[model samples]
Every structure is written in structure tokens, then in C-alpha cells.
Target: MTEYMPIMLDVRDMRVLVVGGGRIAGRKARQLAEAGADITLISPEAEPEIRELEAAGTLRWLRREASEEDVDGYRIVYAASGDETLNERIAEAARRQGALVNAASRAQAGNFIHPAVLRRGRLIVTASTSGAGPSAASALIRELDERFGDEYETYAEFLYFMRKKVRETVIEPETRHRLMRKLAETDILDQIRQDTFVPWSETEAAAWIEREREE
Candidate 1:
């Protein structure tokens, strides 16, 4: 088994290929398109959303079966065709081109697996079961989505701003570490829950730190 190195790829302006027109393929293509990838979907038939994207010019839909040439010059390829033989062919072609290939049918055939992901502003959470059960992974992701709530968005945004401020204002490494620890300990989630938008100032954060130290 190859060790997976997790990475968040910026697919913006990259060419992506989807070799199926079914619901699963459409879902994958839609996500790639949303990430600003130049998606080309090759399918003899397409779902309504795929057709919609084609009409809207968000994605290019080829009304034909995927060919080896379709995998050429693509940064990433998704083989979601119902036909296992065609999917394998697509994967093989993509591998030959040194492009990243995702086999929706067989995980071992591809180099990477797409985890169920939830995005909240700059924060993204993903759930993966190493291809053991995609449905379980999706269910876990949904559970996390419900548990984390919208307050996490505000909390994460505040942390981003806090980190930037700390970098600019505090020069000492130890002091910065202490400050960051303090920020982590503070109940920012509680603040969000209470509808407090206090801007997460250094003074407030430092006071929280002092209070924690005393306790």
C-alpha cells in the first residue's frame, strides 16, 4: 500500500476530465467545476446538471464515449463510467500521461481517493475510510457537519486574523507560542455562540491568557 500524502490542490484554471455522465460523475464534475477547474466531461449521455453546466459554459460536455485522447493534457482525470473496462482504460491512459487519476469504482486502480469534505470558509474538514466504505465516510462527514455548526466559520476566521496579528505584532518566538496557546484556550466558540463579534483583539486575547494563567 502506498502511503498517501494529503494535499489540498488548487485546481483553478487546470484542465480536468470526467469520463462518465451518470449522477456520480456529474457530482464529481460539478465539484471540479466549482473549484474553477476547466472541466471536460465525456459521456454519451449526461444528467440534467451536467447539461445545465454545459449550457451555462461552466463545463464542456462531449456527447461521446471517453477516448485515450480525452485524458491527454489534463491535470486530473476521474473515471466514473459504469463500465469497468472503460474506466480501467481511462485510468491507464491518465497514468501514462502522468496525470492524477481517480477511479470512482476501484480505489486501488488510482493513486488517490477523494474524501468526503466539508468547507467552512478557510477551514476544510475531510473524512476518509481508506476506501473501505464511502457511504460510511459520507455519513461521518454529515455528522461532523451537523456537530461543528456555523460558529466554526467565525472561529476559524478569527483565528486567521489572530495569527496574522501575532506574526506582525509579536517578534519573540516563545511569546508568540504562549500567545497562540492562550488563543487556543479561549472559548472563541462560546463567543460565537453568544453572538459576540469582538474582533478577537490582542488585548482581549492576552487578558484571557492572563486569566487562564492565574487559574
Candidate 2:
């Protein structure tokens, strides 16, 4: 088995092709659509959710079997036709077209694999078992979801806002780096859990940075 490297891809508005009409294809299409990918789903028939998305203009659905030529001009291709042979064919076509392919039936046949992911605002946690155990990966993601609750969303957002403020305010590179680390190491998460977390405005953040400099 090939070792896969984890990466965060920015697929916003990227042309993507999904070859399948079953539930798996619908799921992959929905995830890609949510990430702002320009998706083209090729399937003779589709699940209700896929149809809804097509009707809502979220993606273009070609109601027919995918052809090898359909893989052209796509940045990413998902071969999820539920038939191993069809998926393999699509994967082969995608690879020839210099597109990254992910085969649903066989991860090894493709160049990439999807991990079980959990999102909390800007916080994203992903787990993969190297295609050996998807259920284990999902279970791990579920555990992480329970550990990092809704409060984490607000916490992460606050940190992101503060990070920008820190970069803009703190002039010294070392000081800025230290302050950035200090911000994450603070007891803010505890305060959030206790319902006492108050967001700092730009002025407050600057004041805090100045105080840290003094200390």
C-alpha cells in the first residue's frame, strides 16, 4: 500500500468531476459542492439529494453514464460508480488527463483518499486509517467531535481574529511569535467552558500585547 500524505486543499471554484449516481457519489458530490467546487456529476440516475443540488444550481448533473472523455479539464475526479470496473476505468481516464483521482471502491487504484473529518468553525480534525479501517477512522473522528464541542468553534474564531490583530500590531518578529504562542496557551478555553469567555476587541488585543511586552 502506498503511504498517503495529508493535505488541506483549497478546491474553491475548481472544476471537479464525480462519476456515479449512487449514494456514495451523491455524498462525494455534496462535500465537493460545499467546498465551492464547480462539480459535474455524470450519472444516468441520481439520489434525491444529488437531484436537489442539481436543481438548486449547486452542480451540473449529466444524466448519462460517464465517458472517458468526460474526465478532461477537471482538476479532481471522484470515481464512485459503485462498480469496481467502472470506477477503475474512470480512475484510469482521470490519471491520463493529469487529474487527481479518488476511487471509492478501491482507494489503492486512486491517487488520493478521503479522511473522516470533523469541523468546528475554523477547527478541522481529520483521521484516516490508511484505508485499512474506515470505521475506526470514523469512530476516532466521533470521539474527537465529542471532545471538541461547539464552544471550540467560537474559541477558534476568536483565535483566528486575534492572530490577524497580533500580526498587524506586534512589530517585533520574536515578540509577535511569542505572543501568538501565548495566545493559544492561555486559559481562554477554560473560560469558554465556564461560560466566562469574553472576546477581545482590536483595542483590547493591542493593550494585551503591550502588557505582554512589558512582562
Candidate 3:
């Protein structure tokens, strides 16, 4: 069994290739495009959703089967042509081109796997079963999705702003660490849950850090 190391990829504006035109391929293309990937999908014909995406300027759809050379220059490749043999061939080409690949038809043929992902503003959560099965991973993602709600998005953004403020204003390392920790330990989340969390302004953040520094 292959032990997969979990990672958060920054695929924004990265070149990606999706070789397929069916539901699975459209799904992959949609996800990649949503993540800000520059995608070029190769297939003789694509599903309506993919066509819409192309029309919207989200991704380019090439009307043809993918050749090995198509995998070149792409940072990531998704081989989801719905044909096991074709997927394997695409995966092999991706490997030779030094591009990461996700093969929908056969996971073992690819070097990487897609995990269930949930995003709440700055908060990103992912779950993977490492090839055991997707059902279990999806179940875990659902549970976590419910556990973390929209309020968390605001909470995360608030924390990020405060942390950056603290880093910029506080010169003392110890005080900075203490203030950062205090921000995390604060009851802001409770207020957020209660719909009472007031966003901190730059002046407010600075004043809070100053008061903490005095203590």
C-alpha cells in the first residue's frame, strides 16, 4: 500500500490537462477550473457542462483525443477518459513528462489521488482514505463540513487579519507570540456563532496589541 502524504496545492493559474469529455472528466475539469487552474481539455466531444465552462472562458476545450505530447508543459494532468486502457496510457505519458496525474479509471496507474475537500474561507479541510475507498473519505468530509460552518469563514478571516496586524505592529517576539496566542484563545468564535462578532479594524487591532503588550 502506498502511504500518501497530504498536501495543499496552490493550483492558481497553473497549467493543467484533462483528457476526457464525459461526466467524470467534466467533474475534474470543473474542480480544476474552480481552483484557478489553466485547463485545456482534450476530447472529440464534451458534456454540456464543459461546453458551458468553455463558453464562459473558464477553460479551453480541444475537440480531439489526447496524444502523449498533450501532457507536456502541464503541471498536473487528470486522465479521466472513462476508458481504463486510455487512462493508463495518459497516466504513463504524464509520468514521463514529470507532471502529476490523477487517473479516474485506475488509481493504481496514477501517482496521486484526489481527496474530498471542504473550504470555509481561509479554512480548508481534506480527507483521504489512501486508495481504500472514496465512500469513507466522502463520509468524513460530510461530517467535517457540518462541524465547520459559515461562521468559521469569518472567524478564520478575522484571525488572519489579526495575526498579520500583530506581526506587523509588535516588535517583541515574546509579546507577539503571546498576543497571537491570545487571539486564538479569545471568545471571538463564540460571538461569531451568536452573530455578534464584530470585525476588528486596523486601529482596533493595533490598540488590542498595545494593551496586551502593556500587560
Which tens-of-lDDT digit does each residue in 104-206 have in candidate 3? Answer: 9888888999899899999988899997989999999999988999998999999899888888887889888898888788899999999987898888888
Each model's C-alpha lDDT? 0.85, 0.91, 0.90
Report how far off residue 67 is in candidate 1 (Å). Answer: 1.2
| Candidate 3 Cα deviation (angstroms), residue 54 | 0.6
What would the per-residue lDDT of candidate 2 be over residues 23-106, giving only the tens digit for each residue? Answer: 999999889989999999999999998998999999999989888889999999999997899999989989998899999999
Clashing pairs in 1: none
Distance (Å) between predicted and true CA of 2, model 2? 1.6
Q: Which stretch of 10 consecutive residues in model 3 shows the poorest summed lDDT?
A: 163-172
The model with the greatest lDDT is 2
On TM-score, the stronger of 2 and 3 is 2
lDDT of 1: 0.85
Model 2 stretches astray by more than 4 angstroms: 171-173
How displaced is residue 196 in candidate 3, in Å? 2.4
- If the candidates were sorted by their TM-score against the true structure, best first, what order would they fall in? 2, 3, 1
What is the overall TM-score of model 3 with all chains considered together?
0.92
